[model samples]
Target chain A: MVSSQSGRRSRRWKAMHDLSPRDPHAGALPYGKLNLRRNPFGELEADDWAALALPAVDLDDVARRLREPGFRVQFVGPSGSGKTTHLLALQARLPEARYARCDSGRPLAKAAILLLDEARGFPRGGGSCALGVHEKIAGCAMTVELGAVPLDRLDLIVRSRVERFRRGDGPVPEVCLSRLGALLERHGGDLRLVFAELYEDIQDAAM
Target chain B: MPRCDLTIEFDQGKRSFAPGDAIRGLIRVRVEADADCKALKLACAWRTHGKGNVDKGLVQETVLYEGTWQAGEDRVYPFSIAVPRGPATYHGHLVNVDWYLGVRADIPWAIDPKAEEEILVSWPEGERSPDLGPAFSAPAARRPINEAHAFVVAKVLLLLGLVGGGGLLWEAYRSLGGKNVSGAVQYGIMGLSLAGVSLGVAYLLARNVLAQRTLGPVRFEVPRQYARRGEQFAASLGFNPVAPADMTKAVLKLKCKEEAVSGGGTNATTHTHPLGEWVLAEEPRRDLAPGMGVSLAGRVLIPADAAATFASSDNRVIWSVEAEIRLAGKPDWKKEVRIAVLP
Candidate 1:
């Protein structure tokens, strides 16, 4: 499945290459060259999860369990640990599941499978359901703990996106990659913040 | 109840007058019971209403009659007052300047019976009061530029430059296989250099063309064109970038300012004081590829105790939305749209 997907992506890249300007440096920057329909660094919608390429993580298993009836699960992690991403991914996988923020005032009893985000703020006795939170609740049937993204994993994510714009030929600039690594360390492994800062640097460099 | 009823009527039943004209009117009083009428006063004044705070200016006042009143007495008093040669009447979004002729009968130990009639004061041809200033004057209509047409033209030029430059390089490559290897190499080198330079130039032209094509016109969609004081205002901004470019930052802001003229005649200096400001959007840099545009929504909660929108001849409190877009290798684009905030 990965091979076929890569093959299709390569073909699309070839088509874009042919339409690009002759000057190699003209369209070299990734700013105006990426897919315009979606923002890679910010929040992703339900349909965008299928195309996400990141380090190996077992979110699919959690997603599958979240679909089952009466399975009260809680995903606990620090900020920017992809907890929200996983919850959103689960929402995509389980179309029948109802999703809401902790303060949304949605009646949990009405939903066959409820996905509550920011569950730490949720009041007690709101009925059992899956929750995405920074800390585990006491009575959750299952607790899924996510750790901070390592610098190597962050590097892979950045390389994957940069490589897409380069059409798999040239290496991403060493200075740019090094700067991103430094940012990861400076931000204490806050992956989302690191990405935001990296995106700003890229935008500035392109300008 | 008042012992007498008073009414003021303008001459010739004309409710409108120009500056420097005489305001001729009659005051009529009907005495219903025996009462001590101290004085009959006629006051001419101009006042503002609707927003901010009320402002009033007395044009003229006079005592038309003074004496005791009989139970069945009726009196009509005629008076004439010269309208000031300045300060023409104005109507605006949050302010209005109106003139009135008020007649009041001072009845001792009872409610003073009073009547007021509104009168319109307008500017004569080629005679505008300097106090009215440019802010109160009606804005002239402007013709909008057709940006889409300009975009198409820029795109076409870019395509032509790319095609023409590519053809030259292809032709130069094909000639490299000919005899006289060194000569051919020399000729090819020269052709390659020329093609390289031309391609570079063409690429820059195309990039600039795309930049121009994609950059503006920014549109601000305000939820309400008019707002009450202390009410939150929201607006959505849409920026059309026909070609890809890096957007370093985008921001939305709301500001209220007081503009006034100080000093007199030739030494008059206009001053502006910022009353309040709110930052609506301050986003990190992002890439906007070709065919990509930006649509962002933002809101600002006007301070509950903030000043309302007000305008007069010499003073004004204005509310506006300022949107700024920063693009790579191009000048930042900024625009402001004015809105009304009522009290």
Candidate 2:
């Protein structure tokens, strides 16, 4: 007869061995020895981080949308197009909400609001348990179709929105194109105007 | 119609063997659904490369073995070829030993055919002959052995390409001094390095993956058959052919009214069609019933200019035409037409 402590230890051993990290659904995606640890954000300082991050767009409207459950949107662009950075900046405006990579080991039904970055690398075929959750939560995913918008327009829009948000007196619950046009000129057309007046509205409502 | 499909793998068992050592192993074969194939014969022999007088002059041996097999069945017939004696020898290099199976089908067509396999032979290191014999020496080297070093150097060029691509990406990032150009450069480098690592893993798995040899179902409808004369023959937008455009070669099925009524198999070929022609299979006669169906298959070359069109080509208009048609109802009633128009 085994002692209670020994029996508990045996159960723990069985559980750990059953779990593996190579399984994408249950394990980390095998990116295979990537040198991605370099500080990509090292060049930017902390205080300027907040100001340089949020484009001059109105955040109240965007914040409003995020509060309403089932709200979803995507920012499509090629690699280095700033989809993740833009999403992170958007997150800064929403202090209460939290984010995390959807865990691979747990059933997808067990998680909500998955953010797929390299969606092309998704596994082609897998068991039904993983598939069911993927379909159910697919709508909540915000994926950017790279190459949808030109880079010049994207920079212009990001800068203009930040300018308006800084002014703090644009259209309420709606986008104000006139103010966006002024901000576009202020930046001297050096950047692309991606979100323009609209992104700010979405952010303001969500915040 | 039931057909015989065979796969012959060249497994050069051991590095070396004595002249009389038994060359033994199972020759594997697979038959398709419901076949009335008669006896299958396995034939194997060694022959030197090239044409005429030099061919089969150094023949090792040729043997015919008989075996009876059925359809949907996989059978491995064990074989043992007695290594011949005399000055004949197999050096520790790839020597060709071609083997194929012959199956006689009950089908009326004399197509009852033979399947073949090319096996490679090599001998282990043992007694070194002071004078190299023609049998054991490498395939006659037209060029000196040193010539292969040049080919290896050419393959090394892939690395230069990788470095050049990386440098170009970095320059683009630096020129565009946006929010974080450095971050983009870092990610780009990481992605490329990861790809290299994955390729290595794929190379390791290739030895285990056997190549599959079998014909897929044939489509009866020829694409773009109604093309105006002078118009180029082209496949519809959604249908993607697996064959390369330049190597456009396809076997098309054709038929005539009497041929279709009697359930006969007939086929015909069309001269290569220029890229732009829209081809559609046409009925042999205009008076045919509306419900009648026919089949055809053939290769058409997509014009070289097709790739030069607007960035994606899908958005551009084509000005050339070439066409071919196969009507099952009329085997001999085949047509190949062409069309040209101002851009």
Candidate achieving the largest TM-score: 1
Where in model 2 is the C-alpha error above 4 Å? A1-207, B9-18, B33-39, B50-54, B57-68, B85-115, B122-343
TM-score for candidate 2, please give it: 0.19
lDDT of 2 by residue, B59-163 (tens): 343333344446678766565665443222211001112111222233334345454433333333332332122323221222322323533443454455456
Candidate number achieving the greatest lDDT relative to the actual structure: 1
How do the residues A42-131 of candidate 1 rate in per-residue lDDT, one tens digit apiece?
223344433453513465676676556556778788877765556666767677766666644545445567777767644344433667
lDDT of 1 at A10: 45
Model 2, residue B37: what's the lDDT? 46
Worst 10 residues of 2 chain B by lDDT: B256-265
At residue B229, what lDDT does model 1 achieve? 52
TM-score of chain B of each: 0.45, 0.26
User: What TM-score, to 2 decimals, does candidate 1 have?
Assistant: 0.33
| Count: clashes, candidate 2 | 77
Give the C-alpha miss distance for residue B130 in model 1, angstroms: 36
